[model samples]
Target: MKQKNKKNASLAKLTQQLLAIDDSLTGCMRCGLCQAVCPVYGVTLKEADVSRGKIALLENMAYEMLKDADGLSERLDRCLLCGSCQTNCPSGVNTIEIFLHARQLLAEYKGLSGVKKIIFRFILPHPKLMSFFVAVAGRLQRFFRRKANKNMGMFEFPLLRPFAGKRHFQPLAAKTFSAKYGKINTSAAKSGIKIAFFPGCVPDKLFVRVAEASLKVFEKHDVGVFMPDTMVCCGIPNLVSGDYTSFKRLVKINLDLLSQAEFDYLVSPCATCVSSIKENWFRFRKDFTDGERLQIEKIHDKTVDITEFLVDVLNVDFTQSANAGCTRRVTYHDSCHLKKTLGIFAQPRKILKNLSGLEFVEMPEADRCCGSGGSFTLTQHALANKIGQRKRNNAVSVKPDIVAAACPACMLQLMDMLSQNGDNVEVKHVVELYAEQLTVNS
Candidate 1:
């Protein structure tokens, strides 16, 4: 009887902490406006699937409709937390804050799993260890890889079938970008402009050629390059996982690495990393000391997505000289972190639209989320695929020669969906397309 009482007391305490987040959610106004913009709600139609509904469920625990703490954690993980709901909210409910608070509180209560603790708390923050794993995985990729889609540059792991499903993925690259070009410093060819490059982990590890293509464009345009060594993750994976400690650690590490560099701007081929540095870093800079905060602000001010840098800063003319109606038809997928979060839709399209020998076709709902919400896809693969298939259908409807997205993570999900569906569409980064069009000799 005493033990039972103790357990109930603990549950009550957790419930109270979870409910405290509701104070921040008071602005919700019970408005269903979130439903119109929510990607998960649009597909699931479950009340508990939308941000409004998730808030209500958390509210229910305060009122005692839910009692199982574990079940509540499961419910909370269902959301993409893409901030679309908050972006569309008329009352300005701040759904992202509420969800972040709830996730933090719940993660505090449940504690991260053993595997997750090791991955997020340890491996993710350590670049050297991460690079080692990437190298090993790259070497061992062929022994376990299964051919899933030939044209899409994807394969499936028959070994990881139980955990990864039968989903196809791009095979790990034999050499990482960082390994191929270590601490590179390139002088501007003739354009007399320079930028620091950050390819993030996936591109640096799995999509080395994408980074090469970006560098190719930079070289052809006479843009000087500053590629640094010993950079950490951009803190997106950490932030999304509710591990703010690790996230801040990575941010500080990256700031320390780039603090001594000289560059016009810090450009990356990744949309998520750019958005995180430009937006989220400044928002969370309060956690740092004033000196640290100012440094973060300086870095944030200079950060730009690669496409944005090309089209906006460099003023790369995408107007095809004579191949405006080129034979190759391609469609673009707007990454949620890129289009929805950063308002960087037009620049990538302009780069794509200007490509010679390529016909630009707009996929229906091109701005929709590609269901690759970083770690969200790993935890919630079924829902991720359901959402990704919607994106795949939109791409197929256009029947384009290829699908282009700015983020490599989005490329991963799109490859999985397109590969599984037997769709022949290829996936390429926007820079890859632009790089192909450049007259190298010019």
Candidate 2:
């Protein structure tokens, strides 16, 4: 009887907290503009899958008209949180913020699952331990995964199919980027600019070559690089999972490590990490101590996507005519966070266009979300694959020899979509293509 009473009290407290965001919830115009752009709604064709539907549910719950928080959470989880709806909303509803906060509130009310608790709290916050596990998985992957496509670096894991579901994925690196090159601190040369490099978790572990390419670009531009061994995951995974405790802890860890280094800007090859540092970090500034908040603000100001850093800050010229000597055609995919959140669609295209041997072709709907919303691909696998197939169809429609994206997560999705179809197109980062040109010139 006492336990039941305590549970009801906790539920009542959660209801009160939900009411706090009522003003933001009321901002949704319900004009259904989000339906035009929402990738999940496009796939599911369900009202609850769109932002407006979710907002309506939130409003009802806040007003005590709805008692099924779990059902509402399921509806919220169906979204990609790609910020597409928010970007296109007529009323400028803070869709992402409201969804994220609602998720956090619901998570608190229901408590995190054991698996998520382990991943967000224990594994992610500890870089070395996470690295050790990935390294082990890398060695054992060959035993479980058979080569699906050699050129695309894809493998089919029959053992993981129950969980992963016909997913073809890249193998983990034998050595992460940080393990290979520990803690670099170089002075600025001809460019007279210094930057702290944040090779996001995916690039560091799954796509070391991309991380290497970023370094080569930095060196070619004469920009100083500072990469500390201490930096871990950028906390987006935690934040999106509604594990605010883990998210704040990860942020503090990164801020403390980054504060030790002096640089003109903090640059990352991952669009999500750049967005998290710039936009998401500031969203919760009030929760931090005064000094921590100041640090967060400074870091937020300094953070830039590597493509943006190159073209905007370094002023690298990409205007040269395409060489007739080489004829590899490349198409660019605009990542949602890169384009919608950061407004960095053009800089990557400019970099692609300037490459000596590659011809830059624009893919149809290049700015569409590739459906790899970080963990969204994992939880909502079927919906993610459906949305990814649309992106795949758009890429192939351009008939390019290679498809490139500024974000590593997009590259992973593109690789999967193209490889599954046995398409002959190569997937690469914009920097990798640019780095090849630098090598040719050097």
Candidate 3:
């Protein structure tokens, strides 16, 4: 009888948590404005794939439809979490927060899958352990990976086909960024500014050149950098997977590291990393102690995108250079997180336009998502490719020499789309293009 009472109490707690989204979900007028912009709904054409339909599902479940918890979790996973729907919604509904909170509640009630449990819990929080695994995989990958596209630097492996499903991926670096350069806490050289450089996992591991290019720009501007080896994942992946425990652990780890360092700013070349640190960190700030909350607030205040930091803080300029009119046609893609979530749409474009010789062409729907919502690509590859096709079409329509974006994830999706279509147009980070014009030291 006592055990039965305990079980009922647990159920009651889970139900209460699941219903927490009721208030936010109520803001939805069910006018279906979200249907017009939702990437998943665009491809699937199913109501459940759209935000309003999902909200209705959640609302119904709150009232009585509790047996379909698993079904609800699957429907929620269908979303790209691109914030496109929220950006287009007239009601000003906070879809990102609502969906993320809903996912957390669902995970708590239905429990996270076994594989995600191992990854979010054991694999992601420990940087060194994860790095060790990546190092081993990097060493062994060459044996399995065969070149898929020479232009894009993409690879495929027959043996890994079942898991990756013929996906073309950028190979991991022989040596990670941290392995090449140990802790960097230097005094400012030219700009008299100091920063904590948080090179998120993608740039640190797969796209080292992006981080290197960012460093060149920093060196040119005389900025001091503080990149400790102690930094872990930005905790976005953990939150995306609904593993709050791991996310909080990673946040505390980063907070402890940030507190130890003294810098006027925190910068990342990756847009997702910047947005996650500035916005999502603040979103869940209540999870920390008073002291940690203060630390988080400081980190949030200091963090900025690399382009935003360069042009705004250091006063980067190119008009005075010899190659002020240097001639290359380029179009820019506004990474959804940077442009929509953070409202950082203009700064990157301004940097591109001001490039000495680069002509900045505008792509159609410049702010539309490229559909690379982290794990969404891995889970829903076909749909991702379809969305990429649309974005790729818009990019090539301008006939630019290069398609440049601020986010490496966008670059990855662009590479896949362009490579699959056999288009010769190059995909690169905007910072990479800007770095090419900077004077590098011998």
Q: Of models 1 and 2, which has the larger TM-score? A: 2
- The most accurate candidate by lDDT is 2
Residue-wise lDDT of candidate 2 within 1-442, one digit each (tens)? 9999999998787767677767788777679999999999999899988988888777776543247766767777898889999999989899999889888887886788899999999999899999899889988888889888877879999987766677789889999999889899999998889999999999999999999999999998899999998689989988987899999999999988988879999999999899998998899988999999999898889999988988888887676645545599889999999999999998988888777888788988999999998878878888989999999999999899999998999899889989888887899998898888888878
Q: How close is candidate 2 to the true structure, as a TM-score?
A: 0.95
Better of 1 and 3 by lDDT: 3
Weakest ten-residue segment in model 2 by summed lDDT: 61-70
Give per-residue lDDT, candidate 1, residue 86: 77
TM-score for each candidate, following the candidate numbering = 0.91, 0.95, 0.94
Ranking by lDDT: 2, 3, 1
Off by over 4 Å in 1: 1-20, 60-66, 187-192, 320-325, 439-442
Model 3 lDDT, residue 400, Cα: 84
**lDDT tens per residue, model 1, 1-442:** 9999999998896767665776776777887988988888888898888988887776665443236767887788888877788778899887776777676666766577788788888897787788888889889888988777787767888887666666787877777788778887887668877788898888998888789998888887889988776788888777766777778888888888787667788999998888888877887899998888998888887899999998899997667443565778889988877876788899988877767778788999987877888767777778888898899999999888889999998898888998899888788999998777664325
